[model samples]
Target: MLTILLTAIVIINLLFIYTLVKDLIKHKDEVMSEPASTIWTPIAQVIIYFLSTFGISDFAISTALYPKAKWVSMKKLPGTLNTQCVIPVFVMALAYINSISVGVTTLLVCIVCQVIGAYVGPYFVVKLPEKVIKNFVVVGLLVASLLILAGKFNWIPANGTATELTGTKLVLTGLLMFVYGALNNIGIGSYALTMATVYAMGMNPAAAFPIMMGACTFSVSIGSMQFIKLQDYSRKITMMSVFGVIGVLIAVFLVKSLNTQMLQWVVLVVLLYSAVSLFMAGRKESEA
Candidate 1:
């Protein structure tokens, strides 16, 4: 079931890319000057590399690491996590907003506003200073560290199953999904995080794959279309989409398995590096 679903996903993505590229080429003169124009080829290649090297490998590793994982029919994580979907929803929104923003300080302010708005309504949130953003990045590292530690200690279940859901779980799960759908606007990837949350709550990781992928596909399709219509498309972004599709396909077929622990370690390290890079970028911008 998992294999078939993944294959379908790959095929659908390929078709989407083909159509996008065809449209771009057909309207080349009209779209050439977009902000993401310079990045199309490189983004496509990167996506290819990402899927081939990371995405597929990660999924395989996840399955191997939790072979006994069962399906989760529930709408959300079993307990508190389901009710608290707002937390992740908010975090994801901040992540997406930060991804598209131009300046580090602006990103920092956006993050602050997001965090605060999640708890309270949008108020007089001031622009975050460079130092604050750097601090926030460091804080993110700490949070990631805690999650890793929690997983290692078996303090929390690393995956979930469908059988765990009850009536209440179903209702809450539906609500969480709605929240995730809305949060997709900011560019946050609800897929992995949703999988992780469900897995932690005791659902089958494999089952979570389809749900997350479906949600992401729907959200990204709309988001990408908006970008296309707004002439917000760029070569880099388009290329990323193309290569990302290719990379995911190769990863699904060529990489038969992966080491989950090792992959997690690598992801953690990359995240840390990304944080530092963001900090440095913020600092440089402030100096300039």
Candidate 2:
């Protein structure tokens, strides 16, 4: 199942790479470093996330959510955006959270961590320069991409199913989830962190899914509200996000059958593209 899923994801993403390259060529005059949107970008993301993630997964949504925010920061470019994460985050949450249950304790823990992350993340964002912010975001994307690839290739072993945690270990795990707020805001997103932390505590990947998705919804909501209050976001992209929910609804029932290995490959392609784009933008800035 792992091998077949990985291969399918690879094939799907290889085609997406072609699409990306064509778009890159057409947008050569536009700033390549910015989170760009056409009418199609968000629509395409929803489709890809549905096909690859089995539903409106958090990482996929957050990944979609970041480009708008990326385009919003520092000097606002004309087509750039700030994610109205609140509407869209909950959109996916509504679509998928009810489909699975990970117990009340885990759900509550995820909610608290995410709420804290959502509120705290923006403070960190406003404190930094756009260039520095881009640097961290880009580097973080690369790190995440590598981690996803590692998991796919088994360069680092996937952990066995976990047992419940308690005591000090739980506290330490809590720290990781809290920091994920900052990381997710910085464009690192939260899936890798959730997978590592939750799976480490003994939950299998399947059990971890709903919790991670719920946590990110809260995190992005808090963070998005902060961005919205600042009045520093794009309305155009928000429309794309709203439309993207169609894709989420289409895949809601498919969540239970998803293969983890394939999903990681799809994520890997998106992350690698994001990481490379960030680096290219930084290099362009440096040359200027």
Candidate 3:
């Protein structure tokens, strides 16, 4: 079952990549304003996912892609990058469905809450000040990344063996997912934050992959449509969807072959990169 599921992941990724490449080539001469973001942003997102299941395409955009995508304004970048994520995040969620099945009730609760947040989030994204959004994103990612890193090394009591949450834990998780879902619109990636929530609550770290990916799949898919309706998105760098899939496949294999110690450091570096990058961006914007 695991093998088949994982293989399905590979196949779905390939299909997304094929479609993305076709779209990119077809429109490269027209809408392709910044080629660098097209090339590196996807790659950076996968690297972060590889090390820490952050699964955030926007982190790549803010840190790598946005710097180069000059034609895309900061206000529109969140929505624009999110549209590129819909398919890739869906593909990633499928990769973890089986693992999260043990916690079906928990998953359903999260999805319900996330849907509510995802539906309403774009409106806030439009109205909220950019500095406020950046601050929220920076603090959330920074704290979550640090917690996960501490947990990774036994610097904290973490990496719980529980596969699912019950009672208060489950209800709290739903609430957290709701907040994370809304934050997703303003440039916060929910994957790492969700992982931190579950890990702290005693769920297995491995299980975090499926749960976070699955929840965000629904949230992002629903939320991105509002971004489109609001005309806050850009289509030029959507090709990153394909490259992200490729990065996932590579990361999967490398993860399988690498030693645990080496993987730990990789995760640490990427998590810090994500946190620090957001912090710096927030500070830069606030200063201006």
Model 2 ranges off by over 4 Å = 1-38, 48-85, 155-164, 254-270
**TM-score of model 1 relative to the true fold?**
0.54
Ranking by lDDT: 3, 2, 1
- Winner by lDDT: 3
Model 3's alpha-carbon lDDT is: 0.64
TM-score of each: 0.54, 0.71, 0.73
Order the numbered candidates by TM-score, best leading.
Answer: 3, 2, 1
lDDT of 1 by residue, 1-288 (tens): 334433544554455456567767878775545333344434434432343233222222221211122211111101111111222222222222222222223222222332232222101111234355245434444455455555667766755545234455544554555554433332222444454555654655554443444444433443443334344334323433333444444445565556667666765665556556556656787799
Model 3 collision count: 0
Q: List residue ranges in candidate 3 displaced over 4 A.
A: 1-30, 34-65, 68-71, 99-101, 152-156, 253-288
Give me candidate 3's TM-score against the actual structure.
0.73
Q: Which candidate do you rate higher for lDDT, 1 or 3?
A: 3
Task: Give per-model CA RMSD.
Answer: 14.6, 11.1, 5.3
Q: Number of backbone collisions per candidate, in order? A: 33, 2, 0
Please report, in order, the local distance difference test score of every candidate based on alpha carbons.
0.39, 0.55, 0.64
